[model samples]
Target: MNTATHPSESHEKLWDLIKDIKFGMLTHRHATGMMHSCPLTTQNKKLDEDSQLYFFISRKSELASALAADANVNVSYADPGKDSYVSVSGVAAIREDQAKKQALWSAPAKAWFAGGVDDPDLALLAISIDHAEYWDVKESKMVQLAKMAAAAFTGKQPRMGEHKELNLS
Candidate 1:
């Protein structure tokens, strides 16, 4: 299903699709113009009402430089267990928010930044979401396979899930 969500609903819907998915593949353009993707963990424990998402990454990494060169980026989130997938396109930038770093700081992150929130190499990546697409099929794998086989023999497209596209900005 490809449907347009009402402007009011889109914002909330986008958040619902991604709130629990802890990891996302953030893709950005490199200096060579080639797209590069790296897995990053969303530092926020809860998705704020705004579509923007937060991440913690190494300031010295190429990703940090990529964001500096080009803010346009995409973040993909997936949960195969629930058959829910989301792709978010947004502008990304590295921020030096000390309070945010302290609030989002975690023990696992300490392994990478021994200096903790004060680590010189630590950076906060913020994605100002502009658009998002999601596919949500709340069904079991076996059921989905059966549906696919049935649809194939019956010459019908299997209704996979509730898919929606949102223009967030």
Candidate 2:
């Protein structure tokens, strides 16, 4: 629980892990007060200076409505191959910025938003990250397993992965 406080290098480490993990699962509270989650594609290949993350979503979608009703949300990303995971808590607000949409738009998005940036339903979901936590282990699975076995044989605890918690606000 040493990482329960603010982390010094968490921001940079989080960016490195998430930059290549293009997809994240966004969770929000529904009108009925139930928690819902869905996978979303990130607008940024990396995070902004202020630690904000963006996603393109449909204005008419359930997530958009959820965001309008309650801004608090959580986004999670996982890079299993790299033994990295990130959880970001933030407040989401919808933005109708065609310029930003244009900048972030790609051929992959065309599959959903047929009219591209000009689509009426197209909107940007801006997440102003307030806090984040990450688990980043550089060791491979086999190495971890070997260490665990050695620790068991020696009657010691296995060393776990690195975990950092940050206050982004």
Candidate 3:
């Protein structure tokens, strides 16, 4: 396990693990208490100091309606090739800031919002991160498999990577 001497260090580690990830599986509770998940592209080019994540969603989407009813959410990122995974839990809300939308706006997002940044149906979803946990494995797949085999022979659990949890709130 990797230990962070400071909260900022932990924050940086969390961002490093997820920044290159293309899509995050966002999960939220539905009105019927069922959990729903949808893949959303992370819009942040940089990790904010406050650890907020941004995504663009249609104002009419189920996610948008779910957040309006219940704000708690979790976003999960995985890069199996790199053996890295991150899970972030937070409160979600719709942001009405046009400047923020413009700042995070990109060409690819235009695919979803045909009217570009001025799309009325486009809503900026902000997740105010409260807690995050990550697992990052430094070893290659072959080496990790060997370690797992060794542990299996010894009847012990394999220590494959660094796992840490951070409370950003």
Candidate 4:
């Protein structure tokens, strides 16, 4: 069976897989020289035909503070049941536009801000992705079984194929 897919096809497939999985891990570097990663709910906007960006967080968050100090950030997502994952590297900025806030707001978001649309603590974090790499197992259980069998038979290591990398800059 053919295992390789066209680069664009792989990129789209991975994006579709995780696009609806609302939560992702956002990583940022603090001034104290420590890297912090936290779970965040994200909303996406199609920046262009091929590229997409995410908006998240409130201004008062530690994660937002870290992003303000340093725009460089990384985000990761995965669906364990499907054995698919993505790691994205990007830059982030705090957006304070009222129109933008209104555009992205929803009933669920209101729970995060007590003051509603005019909440002073509300802040939009925009992530401009530079690149993303994804791993998708075509036959997850079968692959695990193959690995176990190989290790049991010859004491040899099993290797999965390379991840598909997409540059969306």
The model with the greatest lDDT is: 3
The TM-score between candidate 3 and the true structure equals 0.95
lDDT of 4 at 142: 80
- Provide the lowest-lDDT 10-residue window in model 1: 1-10
TM-score of each: 0.89, 0.88, 0.95, 0.81
Top-TM-score candidate index = 3
lDDT computed for candidate 4: 0.73
Q: Per-residue alpha-carbon lDDT of model 2 for 115-154, expressed as tens digits?
A: 9889898888999998888888888899999999999899
Candidate 1: regions farther than 4 A off: 2-8
lDDT of each: 0.86, 0.85, 0.91, 0.73
Clashes of each: 0, 0, 0, 0
User: By the lDDT metric, which is better: model 3 or model 4?
Assistant: 3
TM-score of 4: 0.81
What is the lDDT, from 0 to 100, of the residue 102 in candidate 3?
98
RMSD of 4: 3.6
How far in Å is the alpha carbon of 26 misplaced in model 3?
Answer: 0.1
Report how far residue 160 has shifted in candidate 1, in Å.
1.7
Ranked candidates (lDDT, high to low): 3, 1, 2, 4
